[model samples]
Target chain A: MKGLIVKDLLLIKENWKQLLIFVLIFIVIGLEGNQILTFVPVFLSLMVLLSTFSYDDYNKWNSYAVTLPNGRKNIVRAKYIASICLSAFAILFTYLLITISGMMNHHLNLEETAVTLLGCWSAVVLLQSFMYPLIFKVGLEKGRIFLFVFFIGVSALLGLVFQNIKISLPVEVISFLNHYLVIILPFVMIILLYISYKISEKIVQKKEF
Target chain B: MNAIEIKGLVKKYDDKFQLGKLDLTIPKGVIVGLIGENGAGKTTLLKAILNIIHIDSGTIKINGEDNKKEEKKENIGVVLDNMFFPEILTAKDIELAMRGMFKKWDTQVYYNYLKEFELPLDKPIKALSKGMRKKLEIITALSHHPDILILDEATSGLDPVVRNEILDIFLNFIQDENHTIILSTHITSDLEHVADKIVFIDQGKIVLDQDRDELIDHYGILKCDPSQMEQVKKEDYLCYKKNKYDVEFLVADRDKTRKKYPNSVVDKVTLEELMLLMIKGVK
Candidate 1:
């Protein structure tokens, strides 16, 4: 499992120049205090992770990988571990960047930055948790297309429903949810990730490369 | 003990092709060459032995343990046709990853092979030529110090010089009395130089399997004129072909057939001729 993670990380390492360019672009655009900072970094990290899948596909790495000492379960486990590792790294880097930027601009609010970082990380992890099982089932290429269509369809349906229906949460209910969301979100993320990993494990176990 | 044992192994793809109800036992410490034409289930058999593809029905044992058991596979190394590490990775990256993946990965040996093969340590695999990539894959399989090596088309595309070099490596590897190799290739010439045993698969079945020396010594092509061919009994030859000027028969025992028909020409058979006669000749 560690070997698989190391392999993915090594693949990511090869693209450092491209990643550095992205960081430079983020730094320039982020000076305007745009909301892109938190989400973009998280998304960037996820894209980096997804590219590893593409690399694997292009080289037919999974066929060779299955022949290694690691079993199918370990392969799935390593991907999830690597995803979390990459996400955490992205969050920490963004946190430091935002803190330093905010300090330089005389508008530092560590608490607010923390909340935003948490939200971004949660969103990325949730997306990844959903995406991995699908990728394992249909492969990275087709899975990405399915994800795009699925997300667009869901968003459109939700948009139509909200546009037609008028519902508002009470202030107390919203505040109560807000107060506990940080605590609850982590548990939800863990459970979702676990389920996703299990599904991927099953898919890969039966998969013939 | 046998290095590998397969019983009633079967694999099917859609409804078009199926590989067995076949059984084969490969003894340890010898190079066994698997020879077959394209789409003849050579790769399927190799994959089944490796447990890369699940068999529809059958049991595969490696070193007397079920192939599904991961521990048994720890001492096995493989190079599947056109399958390997992502091309974007350098040899150095492979070294890092393999050190963690294999418990007995020998970095010193791995680098030694890389140096010996003249493959650059830092170049991405994509930059290497086809033969270089194959050499890398073979060396990677070797660096783990595996007790068994299973290779599918490991030398199909290389020039003769590189292929000879790789064959020498296989020869060296089999010096250990415990090491075994099952090399599948359509190129029969490669097998002629190094194989101890030959197992030929055609249309998902074992057409022939025998010791290399015995196979070469016993199998022969008996060529004769049309009238002379008439003297040959139906059961005497495995298969036969009719040419424009003469008729040719694949005889199982050259000396026996020569004695039986003194006037007929009983000639030695190459691996290629045997495969062709067995597969393409009329029974």
Candidate 2:
């Protein structure tokens, strides 16, 4: 498992220049007051994590990988571990960039930044929770195409639900939920990540190369 | 104990291709060359042994344990054709990754091999030529000090000099009486240089498995005139190919066939001739 993680990390490092360019472009956008750019780096990091799969597939590495000791299990586990690590780096790096941008613009709202960071992190991680199992089940190329269509369908369904329903919550209930959401969301994401890991493990266990 | 044992192995790729209901046992401390044409199930058989692909109904044992056991994989090294690390990775990175992957990965041994082969440690695999990449894969497999090496087309696509260098390494590896190797290739001459045994597969089934010396010394190709073809007994030749000018027979017992047909031409059968006759010749 450790070896697999090291391999992915090394692959990412090989593309460090590309990643650095992305970071710089996103930082410039963030400095220009495009707060939405905060989420871009994390999303980019996930894409980087996913690109490793393409690399493996290109070389048919997975077929060779399974011949190694504990390969099937370790390969799956390592991707998730490396993902979490990449997510952590992106979160921290984005936070630092936002801080610099905020201070320069005389709008250093640390509390708001923290909330946005949490929401962005959760969104990206949750997206992966849905993506990893599909990737494991089908494959990276097919999985990405499937995910694009799946998400579009999901967004349309959710849009329809919200457009038809108009329910206003009480101020007290809204405040209560918002107050506890920061604490609740992390646990929820953790559980989702665990479930996603389990599904991936199951897929890998039955997978032929 | 045999190094590997397969019983009733069957892998169905589709309606057109399937491997086995096959049985094979390879004893320890010898090089077994697996010879077959493309799509002949050589790769499939090796994949089945490595448990890279799930078998339909079979049991593969390596060193007396199920091939699926993690411990059994620890001592086996493999170089599957066109399958390896991502080309973006350098040899140094591979060493680091393999260190954690294999419990017995020897960095010293790996570096020694790289130095001996003149493989640059810092160059990404993509930058290296085909021969260099192959050498890297081979040394990576060897660095772990595996008891058994299973290679699929490991020597293909290289110049003769590079192939010779790699074959020499394989020969040196087998000097350890505890080591075993199963090399699958269509390059029969490579096997002729190092293999102790040859196992030929045709159309997904093993057609021949015998000691190399026994095969080379005993097998012969007898060429005879069309008029003299009647004198050649069907039982004497394993297979025969009839042409306009002469009738060629693949006889398994060269000395016996020569004694039987003293006036006929009986030449030594190379591995290539043996495979060609066995697959392309008539029964």
After superposition, the stretches of candidate 2 with alpha carbons farther than 4 Å from their true spots are: A25-34, A100-106, A161-176
Model 2, first chain, TM-score of 0.90
DockQ of each candidate, alpha-carbon based: 0.79, 0.81
- Docking level of model 2: high
Q: What lDDT is reached at residue B126 by model 2?
A: 99
Sequence-dependent TM-score of model 1? 0.97
* Candidate that scores best on DockQ: 2
What lDDT would each prediction earn against the true structure? Answer: 0.90, 0.92
Two-chain complex of model 2, DockQ on C-alpha atoms against the true structure = 0.81
* Residue A198 in model 2: lDDT: 96
Residues B62-113 of candidate 2: C-alpha lDDT, one tens digit per residue: 9999998966688999999999999999999999999989999999999999
**Fnat of every candidate, listed in order:** 0.77, 0.84
Residue A59 error, candidate 1, Å: 0.7
